[model samples]
Target: MKLWGGLSVLGLVYAALAFGIDQTFKWWMLHVFDIEARQPVALLPVFDLVLAWNKGVSYGWLSGDASQDLLIAMSLAIAAGLWIWLAKATHPMTAAAIGLIIGGALGNALDRAVYGAVADFFSFHIGSFSWYIFNLADVAIVAGVGLLVYESFTEGRAR
Candidate 1:
């Protein structure tokens, strides 16, 4: 298949995963357990499944007082730009990376649109400090970034 075709397929797949799986999980978390309920399902000693909401960016920055309207607007803009960029991507790996990033952005953007906040349910803790709660969308974004970085380094080596 052509690069454009592959990109389209991958992008749609990513978007579907983000929309279907993430939203379903969010709905369950919100409707079944409620946002404020905290029950630790231990994945490991340092990790737990605990429901939390983030009204702002990563690590809950600007969470308390940030304007929801501004955040949603920015997210929409970013997702659009990213989608266009992903569509234009010529390399399979680049398209995949951008698709993942776009998926993540869309997932969080949907949350903000629907809930006025991002639903973050996974939490990690160690000894004295607890990591900020986050969701699968955040993981996808981080993994996308990691793949992009790896691509950059490996691209240079392959040339």
Candidate 2:
């Protein structure tokens, strides 16, 4: 397939959408909603909105003051590599998946740059079990990765 054409444009649109939505959510939650003041608000029986600052990667791993700049740079670098990959993507799903990943990565990186940490708000729990607090960017990244994995498995077979 040709490189950097219609599919790539579609991917850029998806990326812009993801990034815009992620930033908008973060802005609303932090400013308009004042999530910290009215925090831990239950949205469902098993889910809620809460404010949490993650200085590191997923699940707050590798957290510390020094790692902040490192993480931001790493995220941008990965997003840039994915953008190149998106330019060559032949399938719509692949383009979208890469776009989502790129957008999410950049979104989280921007959070780190502006807030000194990633603003995670969504929380889920059941009984004694609890999941890590995360943001929309995390959701998009996970969904994109899931789509990519699914595409890889199904690629060998017919669509």
Best candidate, TM-score-wise? 2
lDDT of 2: 0.90
Total clashes in model 1, counting residue pairs 3 or more apart in sequence or in different chains: 0
Per-residue lDDT of model 1, residues 30-123, tens digit only? 7886655657667899998877668889776766535777887887788777777776776777777777777788888888878778988888
Q: Residue 95, candidate 2: how far off, in angstroms?
A: 0.3
| Model 2 steric clash pairs | none
lDDT of 2 by residue, 13-132 (tens): 888888999999999999999999998899999999999999989777889989999999899889878887888888999989988888899999999899899999989999989999
Off by over 4 Å in 1: 1-6, 33-38, 64-66
TM-score of 2: 0.95
Most accurate candidate by lDDT: 2
